[model samples]
Target: MSNDDELKQLRERVQYLEDRAAILDCVMNQARGHDRHDADLMGSVYFEDGVDEHGPVIKTGPEYGDWANAAHESVFEDHLHNITTHTCEINGDEAHAESYVMGAMRIKGGKIVSLMGGRYLDRLERRDGVWKIALRRCTVEWMMSGDSSVLASGAVKGFIKGKWDRTDPSYTRPLLLDGEPVSRW
Candidate 1:
């Protein structure tokens, strides 16, 4: 290959890697947004006209956060979303991704907890030099239940708890302990 051809290939390789990184960041941000219950953050991952589906239910991306927050609040006192084993296929301006997700939710009354495993299937588009989800579908593969009474026990009383808004420590810039309890559940 000519030198110019080799350089062109190198540049394309770099662009491909950059696109993959951006896509992964966008997928991970969804988990962060849900755990923090930050509607704006969640919505930011999607285009205004984007669509999301969870089985029989469907919603526009911009309005999904509010609905999700209300649903979670009614059932779980606290929750977390974990993303793993992601794969992406990029084709120019559009890409598809599949991400494994596990959700651990401490149910209200602290009597029960639920664990759900799922996958997020997304189709993303690069628009105006930004990548965002244009469509997403969620699949629930398995679920289990367990006792969560320990969450309210003294054993965990000293641990910093998570919050459902921007006040969550994860949002704290330059995060320092400051020698205080920080916040609680």
Candidate 2:
């Protein structure tokens, strides 16, 4: 109706979108942090007293960081977390979200553990202009198990490049076209 009213409405809509984007960034940060074993980054996604339930075990933000990092290091030689769809319902300063996730791990016992599908349900709250997780519940829907060693049973000799930390090539290597033995992937 009035120009002033229209401008106010548009600003509110922009704020809503910005909030949604910030929340999604948190979601991705969790995935990347866990996979990279960056405990601090992972913990930053949550409030100081935030809680997370991996199955029936519930832990506070700091507790989860310690537990998850230890478990990943002891149980898996390597692991990757991939987040898919994310849907959030914003209610002013609070929101509820569910993020679909899949993960594959190279277990220490030579097993390949695959969580084919799962969901991270989150309760978020914004305080002091910052949105953070107040709670999270992870539910695994399906999984497949295999032998990790078999994947390299007949491997050729080479320096297969990868690292658990920021030293990974993804942090530095420039794009290049594929050559004879290098697939550029």
Who wins the lDDT comparison?
A: 1
Off by over 4 Å in 2: 109-111, 148-160, 169-185
Question: Looking at model 1, which ten-residue stretch has the lowest summed lDDT?
Answer: 176-185
Q: What is the C-alpha RMSD of each candidate to the true structure, in Å?
A: 1.4, 4.2
What's the TM-score of every candidate structure? 0.95, 0.83
lDDT of 2 by residue, 1-185 (tens): 99999999999999999999999998898888788777788899999999999987899976787789888898787788899889999999999999999998877765566556799999999999999999999999998877666556645335443566665544445633332233111
Error of 1 at 104 (Å): 0.5
Residue by residue across 1-185, what tens digits does model 1's lDDT show?
Answer: 99999999999999999999999999999889999999898899999999989788798888988889998999988899999999999999999999999999989888899999999999999999899999999999999999888766777877788889887888887787783236764
The per-candidate count of clashes, in order, stands at 0, 0
Q: Quantify how close model 2 is to the true structure by its C-alpha RMSD in Å.
A: 4.2
TM-score of candidate 1 against the unseen true structure: 0.95
